[model samples]
Target: MRSWGKSVDTMSSSSRSSQKENVSASRFGPKLCGYCNEFLSNLDLNFDQLNICGWVHSMDYHDIHKSARSGCQLCIVLRHDNTDPEDEHWHKAALGAYYKGRASIMMFLKSTSTTCYSAMYGQLSETISYPGTSRRQRVLDELDSIGAYHDLNYTPPKSTESQTAWELCDAWIKNCIKNHSRCKILHSASWYPTRLLYIGHFPTGYLDRDLSSFNVQLHLTQDKPPKGGYMTLSHSWGFIAFEMLKLTSETYEYRIKNGFSYIELPKTFQDAVRLSRFLRSDYIWIDSLCIIQGSEDDWIHESKAMVDVYRHSKCNIAATAAQGPTEGCFYPRDPTIVSPLEISLRLGGEEENPIPKKYLIVSDHSWHRSIEEAPLNKRAWVFQERILAPRQIHCAKDQLFWECNQTTACETFPFIFESHIEYSKGAAPLALNITSLDLTLSEMRKLRFCETRHDPFPGNFISYPQESSYSTYSNISRFDRTLAHLEGATIDEKIERLRRNIFLDWNNIISRYSSLELTYKTDRLVAIFGVASRVQEALKDMDIYVAGLWRSQLPWMLLWQIRISDTPPSYDCGPSWSWASFNRDVYFYAIPQPHDRVLINVDEAHDGHTVAKQGAASSHRISYLKLRCLLYKIEPDIAANSGKQSRTRFTTPTNPRLGFRPKSLHTDCTETDDYWHQAYIILVIGQHEENRLWGLLVRLCEEEPDCYRRTGMCWIDTEAEPNITEHVRGATDKDKA
Candidate 1:
């Protein structure tokens, strides 16, 4: 990204001129004496003016004509006043001329000044020709003459001796330790060859060789032949030493009192020491160096700590990579295959000029198995003696195979809902509800049903819950009841009953529906009805019900089914009584009967007077039915409030019955005249509240004609006499008629 600004081209010409002039007069430019400057000013200078005169003549001319730029010689006599005080412009002009290819002019200017080479180079590069090689060489030589080369290459190599393989490996190990301080080290047989060759099986030829002889171990069995040519004698020696170091470091620390010892040999030991000096270690405990290898007692005693040495080391550098194919090394070969006679003869010391070979045996069976199977075989064989016991290898492999099979089976299993449902039914009811009962049941039945008709196991399976709730009622009681009830009932009747029942229950228990107050122990059961109740209450409150039940820790309600009307009706104007429009005027049938009940009468205009007429005129009866329907709708709220035991006393509203007195009434009527109407309203409200108190009670008794509970009842009304009277007085008698 470029800097946030316009380019320098946006600057005015005056600003550019000022910048040029400032640059010219700065000390960074070529230094010039007043005489030289005067000479330049007097000359009818062209770009090549400096080249026209000889150096000596130019100098002489500059001294005489230095102040001749002014017209009068007498003006030059007034030394200070005659000289141009604002010489920046002239300096800039000189720079401009140099930049315009006046190399000789810049050279002339530099020759007349006492500036250093660097300053001359700077001015030339900025205003004239750039500094050439000769100038740079002079600067470097000057610095060298003063002796500053010591800081250039501070550290130097000690010697030119070539590093042996063992030395290189040891150094690499130390470097690894310094870099990674927290990695565990492990090793195998190749890491302890010296001890193994001495105590374990080895060819007589190898054993009888002179102690100083470096011979690589070789394998005769045929498989893939080792990759490289014969190993060198010197490299074999390095391998032995490397192995010895690993064994000694890993095994000797715990046995000896001083915990330090050295391997001693005549010429061989001396060469090993010299070669080992090239190696480095941050903290190594090589077994040969750490234990008195020559002493059998010490070796036997110290060998016990070998496990800790390898296990605790930052890293182990095994000589596993040291040997190459064709080298006579102890490379493990497959036992099932036999080597050719010629190859065996070559590997053995049969030939007149036998070549030495070193082969890295990956394992005893390198080519018999696939790449995927190789690791298991190697892990089993390599660590058999030190880490794994002979008997455990088979068991370990079996376990590994079993686990892999199990994983594949799980992934490939097919989903069957019937089988799942069957399985769920077989399980304990509590457990079923607490888990994926629906899914389990569905899958059980699906598997069974599918299996009877076709294959039980499909190619693959993905299963989810069949329904939100499947184990809420033990033995599927609720589902059975619902099915039975819907057998002969109309959809509208079922819906209306369900609505009334839910509203009454919820209204009765509304006060007790707080999340903080209710405690839900299990997810299954609570996810069903608990969720439903909260949703119903939230809807009634005239608040947008954003489902946050999951966000809350306590279970509130479970969603069953949400019904969205085709034409979205206003909340208060909905056909059914909603919680918000509970007391609003509306008419509905109580039980679909001709003359079932008259709950409320709001048409009577007499003050404190009301009439409850059963099977009256259709208009009057409908009007009365509307009031009763509205009252019945409000019952759910009352019932909902009553459900909560903690606040059961306050379940019903304080004013259960509402009475209105119109001002157009001729005379006030006694409470006795409207006793039935008032009593009925009170009775209905109280019964609704009671039903809400216990859903089961409402379910059982609500069907009775006089099922109202009278204990919890109260009344409230506003005085509308003034408004009624004014409306009546304003209207002409004919209008009333």
Candidate 2:
């Protein structure tokens, strides 16, 4: 028989079972009975609604000799007499063997007798109607002929203990490397790091090799830096000595002279080095090993280069499965769990000839769950690492996951969803349409499309710009289109726009990052400094980038509110005016205000002590900030004050007190302490509530004399019995607004 195959692109998304209809009709029309041959000759196949299997298209109904039981490939294969249809073991084993080339499903079907195919066909008709079976069958029938379907009989050569993940990952990476348009990397020296560690050799099995064997530093000569790409390791240290493998004064020279032996490093690091070498890369950059851990100066310099290290690396090896440094990346995986199930159909009871077994690699959705909920994803540092890396291969516990700028894929669902495209249900005219757009915007719009937001404060809430139900959809769609439109324009300009937009959307990023775990609260700014630095580089103008706050975007930013927490942080790490001062959870919800209300007046000038002014250029490692702003002294309402809680109320020489909450009070005032008499507040922004007013509250930063930090947020509904007219009159500074 002549071989038959076609490119995957030729087939429709739902063309799995239907492809065979065309192929079989063209090849076997002469062998079928007259009626079957006539039906096959003029068959108008509906690509939209194909049969579950090709039997409907390949069978001869008139002649018993060429009946579906004997003539159809699918019917003949689905009736196995040697194995039980319900036995998963044989099913999985057969599927594994076929994938391993030890067995062939196509060959088996041709060789099997279809005399008893009717009984198996009936059983399949019953079970295949089940939703799970139907879904799996669709996925399997969809696989291209060239794809690997795992089998039980496959084994590695003696030189290799088992299959290495690197070979698979290398193949994937090499394929991606060829797509020049999508594979370009920024090689600018500023962010593109030069120095790296060269792990000893390649093609070496990691099973029993001594870690010490891979120890060599590849110091790139200034004239000739290695042309090929390098790999980076992003894993959690898990209470291990992160400061141990550093370039300190005492160890710097010795370490430079004597390269870092993999055996001395943690298991996670060792695995990373091995994987990098296997990926055909000459260099690997492990954070703890590359950076000077104990040296402050070296850390200050190298820490700023974090963006370059991750963004420029060819691939980031994430030890997603490992909880700590001690846990290695690779773990034993059961073939049964990894392999898809192969099911066979049985026909004609106990009296007839046996049929061939049909093979399928079942789709497992659990892989997505494992990847998303991986322990590594929970870390604050790893969050940035995962998002920044251009391409990353997650060494997960259940299965390996691949993520890039384009899409996220796992072994089970190889092509679940494209990153930049949208997919829909069913066949045309409602079929899937793939369009390029910002994935983030596309997702956010989906949420908005289905969500219904009700007016929370209907009575006397601010007269803010009321958003229609479809407003979010329109806004996000416009943003998405704008991004897509800038693709071929000046790259630098596009990057600058992306950077600025990222900063504009900083609220969402900060809200999530602040709640994550961090060993040192002071490192909050340093940890995200890489992200900030990248954004800064894209900016056409120089603006003050304070600890974790941007001076250019203080109005909306200053309204950040704290979420509930056990222990509120102190304000020593950063100025009280920034969220960086608070280590607890925070979020940004729009504070209702009039459409025309001006939040702050940047052009207006007041005395140095009274006007809002930015401090000097923020040093990457600095803690303090200097800002001058209008401050108002206020007294707390003792009855409404909640000790240490984010909720409270304060009165400004006015009858209607302003209700608010602060992450934490900084006056060293106990519940019984009369700090309310000395405490001061600033109105971040005022809202028009039924023509009345309300505002976001900020506590005075005493250290800076005039600057203030966000404590809590509030809305004053003056139309209610407890009026806020006096508070508004006292707090509103029209000139400042």
Candidate 3:
């Protein structure tokens, strides 16, 4: 067989599946049966309408689900578009569509079968680049290739543990190390973490080594920074009835000297050790083993430096596919599923390009499956681990993926979505474009294309944006674009934007980080403290971290509002003045009016955060926060207030006594409008040009002398009566925390 593969220029996104490769796929490509050929003939018609595909007669919902487990290529592709929770719906939809006999229905087909996809060329040709427009266009172009095609690969590897998988992984690392200078780390001995687990040298590869001889030991690195490079592990501890393996205060001394056997470690850790050794790294950091378990002081101290452990390491291994440690980092996958299916088309062409032919399909939701929708990415701590790590190898359910600060490449796509430019050896240095305007690190990260902003105030109640990204097509995300434009979503791209706003970026991070789940409520601030430290470092210490709010971004940061979630807040969190006080997500949704100035003065700001149980996490209750600001008694339109939370209009502009009619006011508590009826408006900002005011709705703190607790965020329309702004300033300033 003769083969020539060229790296294709592109972009795009999907769900996943696997299947046995069709014999002779390496030559003329898999021969599509007559049913698929006829089905392809009616490409425009939906699957349900394509009754010509007699294969549907054998199609069963249980078969699809069964095939999903058995590594059926087509079924896995369907799963690429779904999370586990949503899989049954797609399966049911396929069956229901079969019965309906509609055009909208062989369920959605792709390139792995008949239509040929070009992404695999990258892996084949050893090409790596940033995202651009070409890939998506190619994917969009190949949309019609949904047929019963055979695997492009000639043979299947034994499992993800095969030499083939490791070869692919090695290629990614080789390119990252040799080609990507940015991803390379220059570590001094000082960079080592306080503790590290030393997986004793394996002279033989893990697969070849005798299990009885393999040893593991705790290497306390505080006294001596190891000379060799190290790797880090990101895995789920998972819930269990009994205690899992760990280094405790009691075991600390014994673990350091005696070191347990390889069998003592969990399956995930063992897999990590194998990978680390395969990568030629002897030392690896695992949280539970490195940090003293059941010891709060040690955990807190080590957790504080968690950022460096990941950031300074040579690489981080993410067991992204696994739910718990028991699942391990590897799985036996059908090779055909990872390898795109192939079929040569007979459609007539002018020799340069083909005609009206549709063939080739893709799992557009691979990102959702391999990482975003994966179990590990959901953890709050993983966010920072992902962002801070210089590079990472994701052990996905079906395949492996590489992610670094520079780019992301999966086994399926095997390349990045970069603009395609023909290259030859010794070509002139490639010119990289740098934006002339000096953007802050945060500002630089926020410059994304096709991002949508939700209404700041929807109806009367504010609706918070969830973790979901805005999608243009149900299967395609806004991030799904061409490589030339870098429109495709990178794993960390969205979070990267949050790094830009300096102060505003922190708000974005809080909104994002706060939405994640935490096993320990007290770790709310602890889990994200590393990210905070990074943001602070970027700020060059321009802003002081007063609990969650920045001292400089005050008033704005203090305006963090609770999301309308059924999940209740933990009173154990920081002072009510900070967003960290809430267990559910809180958003800095209220934007200060244009040219708006803070009318409130921070008379006294002190961070008296004591640890929740007994330690010093950032979210501890505040020592003191006194804001001296004028308060004006305001009233809402009874009718508008009664109806579906409508905007309170300033109908009585003639009477200043009616006060500043709040354009929008949503209190944290829904139990009563009584607080709204007796609200005092404190000016957080006054926008003169816009004729609007943004501030907090507050009520007097009965016990405190001239103090108040924030009730809700208030936006007032001064257009009706501009003089109303003066009345707010005329009111007496009261201390508030």
Candidate 4:
């Protein structure tokens, strides 16, 4: 059955072709050889030779312009002579070839009919056909009828510009490679060859999974921990492929086998140098020296490796004692420390040294001042500023032999002497316990100061006077006030002096709190003082005055609230009747009441007390009334309670229940002619506060009615007498019945 259907379709197609050929003959007259511009002249000529020759000519001279009107006549005649009627099989084959060519032409000429004839003649046969043509012409005519002819050779000019997808891809790849090559890479030991390159602000975690696919590791460092900063890798180009993969995963390991440890710096000068040398060793990495600080790109790249540097290092040697025991002790290193003998000899001879060497003599009393007052070389006695004082001996030792003249009790020489004195008070010491002249001076000062300032009172109290040592103490004593009174002090000097005293006091308080070690209490005190100082500074110009009250007493008020709340301090009690009362008196009276306009619209629905008690009320219920009050510059206090003693309330209703409700006997007011005549209803509703209803009522009153009247009552003069007898008779009859 399929074969039969195919045979029938073939027959129908052949019949349609025959009909199209007859139509072409009627329309174009005859077929002409495209190569010669002449009629075929013989239907029996060989078609294969002619078609092949035409195709070859079209391929060779397709773009060439000829001076003659059409192709060579001899070429067309030779093509016709090659055709023969005896070769019926060849003619049939030629027909099949033409049908195949027509199919291609139809496909190319689908958009325009003119292109079909042009393409067919230009390629197949270079001859002009008559208006009504042959078999080839019939095919062209049929294609034109179907609007399936278009010039395949026609192309639009290259005026429009657009990038192909592949071009964009190539450009992106090139940029990525360039970026990767220029960037630095950091590697992890665990990941080995898997490296990460620092890409600007690209997240490390995002690159982790991405780089992992390409066998690369992404490392990131956080200022605190867990996340932040940039990504790092081992090779510059590794990030390109890593980014291309678009990996997003955890880049850090939260749990590890080892715990955190601290690196301790050596105490001795020789040992400190040795430690510094060890840090500079090939295997060791010191960020300051190893990372290139001047290069922004280098810093950006190395910043991501900070986590690895700290985490993988033997230990981090935190230099807490870098700042010594004096103001500006953090001065840059120039005059280096040497042996104590060298420094002492350099100050002329020990005996010839004229400059007063000030030693800070800290004792239980005012020993420093007593030592200063001693009849020793006045020039040799100097007092060092004690801010950032060293807590350990090494730092003091480091400064002792330096060119600077400052000295402290913790230095090696001073330490040995003090230790000997301490032991001598209790037990016998070795020959090494012999104290130096300087040591003797320090001890004598300690003794004299103790005698005067450390006179134990009945309660073991000692009164230290201002004439004592110049050691800057935390306590604001008569000594500090006296110092402030000194003449010729500049603004910087005053500020510095004030800062010194304030810092001392602050440090002392911190020390006291530390001894107690109550974290919450310490934090509270710190926060209170810090916040108070901030507030004072911020409100320097404002008239607001903040009393220096103890935070412990007033637990309800926070420093932030005091600075930010709109209402004044008195109303700060948390939502109580007293707070409401305070708010009413203070805030309500802060702005003066307006009295020019007489008429008032009462939005009873939104009245605070009413809304709080009754849940249904719309926000816009009082809107119109509010507008009227605002127009007149009236002080429209919404929800005003009628009675004198009623509490001023402010509460919002829940969302579920809202809008107006029906009027009842419970409603506060009834229609009255006297007041109604003078007053206006800004709005009217079933409920008193409905602005829409009241607005309509007000409009009607303004336009239509000359005077207001009650629905069922008449206004009578106040002095009129009542008909008492008639009212009494009516009451009596009702009682008898």
Candidate 5:
């Protein structure tokens, strides 16, 4: 076969036709073409529908787009998976030969075909699809049938820039409280933020001045929880300064004597207070307003309590679309844009058959467009808040969205919005229960042993009292009872199952947390510390959170690969051995089979000598990791790096035929991107099933003679691989090249 781009770079239109041939291949039955259809059905090529699939890795992004635009079905599917369905040109791109219909079309086919059920993995997980053949016309006709049911159906109201929208938002919160009786609240009353801004006044700013505005302040003199529910505001403090309005040493006493004037606050703050008071909440917690902005001691204590502050609240009011304070929470929008496309189709899967079935094909990117990709959701701090909070009301550009621990829905498709987070290869589907995020590492290892699963098929999306998935995840003690009530026959099995589940949840958390951007590099671990502390408490020391990883999942945890294009942190976040050491997206790919051989031992973690800086999480900094592991010297391929090194290449000292080459290699960026001559591999784990050796690439730490700095990771597979742990243990210093 010719190289992939050979045809694209040179071949003319007429010559490119290799006869529109059809053949039965790869179990998806008859195929349309040799490339796309064939590859889609190949099990070996399947990598759990992750971001970097075999399809994405095999073809260049530009090349794939070219093929997709030129009418390649396979390329179309690949491009579709990578992009937001909201792209108008995407519809055009999917049109003609490349078009596979919108996500709703896929939803109809998958829901009807052999391919769905994760609709709603507690409403978000894999969106499986049938690998079989079907024409576009047939898919469209089927969707129309569902559209015909519109008259009898109760779709979510189309959003509007009206006061009614605010009422609907309130209804969503009320529904959660009334319906989800078992949902969790992570913060203990003792850990509540020391202060909360009163939201008694209207958003527009109010003062019944004659009645004494000074009485507005409720200065707490005792350790008593407030009587009324308090909501938390999640927003971006824009660059525009509002120093006079914020709480500080100078303003604290003044604010205590006199509550805030809503009119003087930023637009975002004004809207947040408005929503809070409207919801009957007595107080609202905003970081800058509630926490003393300039006081180091106060900021440290308050910052550490972030997780509890947000999780403790009745709800989080997110100004998702607001890039800055001036861009208030309420965004004006056209109601028609978010409304579903109602249509009627034939009863059966025939083209133009005359029996009617009504349907409402909603925007495919409903929740995603409104919330996930929202500007505020991208903040590093929001990562923890999003997961920890029991429920949230997101104020977005297109519409209002509701996200609880179990479901994510928007005004556009107010049912379970069918969307998927690009799950990493080894991470577990996000936990259905907020308190269930595990602090263990075994999930990463055990995932390879368990059967790969797809959730059971679900029935039609109907209008009603929505599906209830509430769980009573009150605390770690509650989890113990939950464990006792589990399906496993043996207590040990139940515990193990819980362990693995939480571990999987941890994987998802870390992978996602790493992808976010932080204003302060030091806040990397600080921002997520509450999650760590809670999970640690829940696990009751099932696994220790050392730096950015768990103690139990070491070797395997260390195997996590930095996402391609993930840049290095400008300052030290943690040890080179930990993913927290860098500021970038990272993921673990479960390619090699299971393993039990651990070739390294981590010593007692050393603490950083420096004082925990302001805005840093207390008691969670590790200076460096001291590991006692077998090391092997490897020589660089000089020919590969004759110029400035883009990526350092390595090979074993042995002959080419017998040498080891890593399956994947990622080099860290530095002040000077140069090759390290004194390169070595720290043997971490040995896997027998895949005959692979997983290790870390390190170089002698120039600053410290005996220490080593992790430069990258290595996964080597050789046909004649030996017992890695045994081989490394028997070798000596002479093995160095």
Candidate 6:
């Protein structure tokens, strides 16, 4: 075999020379063609005609409007003068077939190494369709049959103006408390925290302030929990006003125990207290007030109960408009934009006998849109608050939005809002729950395929339009949607599937959570621990619970990829081997179903000092893992690099993972340090797919000899297959798996 580190220039030159000599002259159609009295000549070709023709130099073809550059493969072979890559213009009469379409655009972008091209393609592909009809037209036509088209076109009246959000919040809360029992403060469910603040009462027109002293109480264990439900405030801590009363261990024991008052509190907390009293809720849970600041024990204890605190509350008051607590909950918006448009339709033809119709077009904003554009909605901590809370009243800039487990409503079109039940259940069809009869495999495949195509990305956690769309207007209710998703022959089988899917969803949630920014890096595991706890409860029957991965399907969970173009932190947050190690975006692709993948035996896990242990979970902390598996030394590919030394790739010494090729291990930035070269790869698991063994790649830590981190995720089929023969290397004396 040739050496691995060959120069790329020598290889390309030799290959090109051989290709030119073998070209057949007869294929050029007499070598010349006349177009507009200009002679165009055909040249020797290599690769394929489609590949050559599809080569585009610039992606922004419209901005660079000109003939195809000579750098394009097709330009060297076939002479074309006028064809616009962006337009229907063709080069030579014979090669005039190229046209602008999504497929061609994808082809041109696919050859690029830049991830930005892929991101751009993803955006452009969303609008691509067959010529003649715009994507927007398709959407409008789809809505036409449902009578939603009128609502779609309805505009606000010229004279109408927006209303104050405070009035709207009052109206929504009073109506829900009176009519919706589900939203009413529960009398029996009484849960009290260690300390509570009595936000001074508010009167009809405005809130009365008693700045001299603040009412604070330290609830006694003997005291009965509040008879009525409490309200929770979910807002960003924009700035802490020290001038306000501060709580500490000393104050909790001495000053606050008797009766303390303070003049200062953030605007958000003040607004929340006002809303709480207006809604008739007695108690409120404000973290800054309830928990002693800088007390680790209290923080940890309270943080663990985050899910319960939000879930049991009567309602969470989300300051969606506020960037910080100081800004308050209310946001200013244009009066004209917030008001609905009026439309008049003519029923009869001709002005003499025309029948005029008037319709009110309510500019109803989807709940998804309201949450997506909100500033507070972007905070990571608030996400869990929104998800776990049984109900939330979003104080958005334009209007107040009501959301609970049952439904979502906004001020402009409260009754017309979508049901949250179906949305929360995900994309399963409603039919599976209605009928006890088994669905044929063919039927199940049809339903599952629909879920696969939605392409739920990390961003979906933030935008949620796909899930909302599936649950609201789709045929299934949220309750039934769960049944549809977990369809199986028996209840036990269905439960198994549900457990597996729940874990999958956890992976999805973590993928998004990892990408989000946090004020404290240490809070990484703590921020998502509640979600992990919830998933653990769902998979309780399963024996294995490793750090972030489950023992039952650890192999599949290990197949996570840190998204390309995302910059990982220089300092590790957790173990490098775990996705939590990098404070960047990570994603997991579902493993192909029913594959023959065997977990490496623990006995086989160790070589020298390396130790392998089954994964274990700790309370409110990161999981630790160690596995001793196959190790491979990386080397430069000389044969592949003959033509360009700069473009040379690193490959394994011996053929590893036969059918599965290694993905590019490099980060998006070209200036990244050569850490991978010094890094060693460990095979975590082996999969038998299509008669070949595919192994997952893990990067070994030089500092911590036994530990390793996940590198580029999958070793898949690649366009340029480098020589990656495995190199046999002996393990260190103490290198235990």
**Candidate number of the best TM-score:** 3
TM-score between model 3 and native: 0.70
Please provide TM-scores, in order, for all candidate models, with all chains considered together.
0.15, 0.59, 0.70, 0.15, 0.67, 0.59
Candidate 6 lDDT for residue 216: 43
| Preferred candidate (TM-score higher): 3 or 4 | 3
Candidate 5 TM-score versus the reference: 0.67
Best by lDDT: 3
Better of 1 and 6 by TM-score: 6
How many clashing residue pairs appear in each of the predictions shown? 65, 16, 60, 39, 14, 44
**What lDDT tens digits, residue by residue, belong to model 3 across residues 1-737?**
11112112121211111121221112123433222333233332333333442222222234445555544444444444434423333333221112112101223422222332112111112122212222344332222121112122224365776656665565566566655544443222448899887775545333535566677877878676687778999988788714678888998888888886888778888888887777677799988888888887897778778878887888889999888888899898766666544333322222423432223343434554467668888788886787667678999888887776444666665544222221211211111110001123423333423354322111212212222222111222112222223356552443333322344435555666777777877667767777666666554433467777776657667777775544444546566567766776787755543345566777667766534333554444644567666556666556555767545643333354544456666666553636555556667766565566777767776677676666667677777655666665454444322
Question: What would the per-residue lDDT of candidate 4 be over residues 1-737, giving only the tens digit for each residue?
Answer: 11111111223434433322331121112222232221221111222223322221111111111201133322222222222323322222111112123111100111111121111211111111111221344334422332222221212122111112112212222222232221111112331111222222222112111221221112232322222222111111111322222222221231111211112211221122222222231122223223443444554454433434332332222222222111111112111111011000111223443442211111111112222221210110011111111111112112221010011121112111222222112221111111111122222222333322221111111111222222322132322253556457644333333322332232222222222221122121222232223222322322121222211111111101111223332212111111111111111000001111112222211123212212332322110112212110011123443446232211112211111221211111233344223322221111111111111122123433542211111111112212311222233212211
Off by over 4 Å in 2: 1-164, 180-194, 200-214, 218-224, 242-248, 335-372, 415-501, 565-568, 591-596, 602-651, 654-675, 679-681, 686-694, 700-709, 717-737
Task: Pick out the ten consecutive residues of candidate 5 with the lowest summed lDDT.
Answer: 117-126
lDDT for each residue of candidate 5 in 1-737, tens digit (9 for 90 to 100)? 22211112233323323311222232332223434443332312221221221111122234445555555543444444343433332322211111122222222111111222111110111121101112234223322332332221333344433545665566666656654433433324434578877656444323222322322342442455667678888887666655435778888888877867656677787777767766777777877777888888887777767767876788999899888888888775544445443333332223434443333433344455456677887788887887767688888876787776434556654433323321112222233333345212222233324444422111111111111111222222223344455644444444455554554456656877788878878777777787776666655535677766666666667777775444654335777776777778887643223334566766655535122543444655446666666676787767656778655555556443333546557666542345457778877766555566788888887777887778878776634344443465465535532
lDDT of 2 by residue, 1-737 (tens): 11122111233423422332332332321223333333222222221121212222222112222233334332222332222444322222111011112121211111122322211111121222121333444233323211332221222222111354445455456544544223343223433464577764466434335556656673533545665678898887776565445445777677778877666777787777777766667777877767766766666666666778887788899998788888878776543334333443222222341552333423222332365457776677876776566677888775566666444545433422221111111121100011111233233323333333433112212243232322222313223444665667554444334433444345556666777777766566667766665545544243446557665555556566675444544544554546766777666544333442433434421221111112112333224333333345567766666566454556556334444333233331123344354555544444343342323445555666645545454444445423334444454344232
Candidate 3 achieves a global lDDT of: 0.54
> Which regions in candidate 5 have their CA more than 4 angstroms from the true location?
1-161, 181-191, 201-225, 241-244, 347-353, 415-486, 563-571, 590-594, 607-622, 637-659, 670-674, 718-737
When 4 and 6 are scored with lDDT, the better candidate is 6
Which 10 consecutive positions of candidate 3 have the poorest summed lDDT? 429-438
Cα deviation of 312, candidate 1, in Å: 4.8
Off by over 4 Å in 4: 1-255, 258-504, 507-737
State the lDDT of candidate 1 residue by residue for 1-737, as single tens digits: 11111111334545433332231221212223333333223221232332332221112222222323322221122112112423322221111112112211222222223321100111221121111211344233322422221121111112112222222223333333332221112111222212211111223112222334432122221332322211101111232443333223334444322321222232322223322323321123333444465554554444433433333332322212122111221223221111100001112122432542221101111111221132222221122111111001011111110011001000001000011122122322221221221122222322232222322111112121122232233333222234355557654434333332332223222211221111212111121222332333333322222111211100011111112223322212111112111111111111111111222222221110001111111212111011111221122234534565332121123333322221111111122342233222221211121121101011112434533322112222113323322332243324311
lDDT of each candidate versus the true structure: 0.23, 0.46, 0.54, 0.21, 0.53, 0.44
In candidate 6, residue 183 scores what lDDT? 37
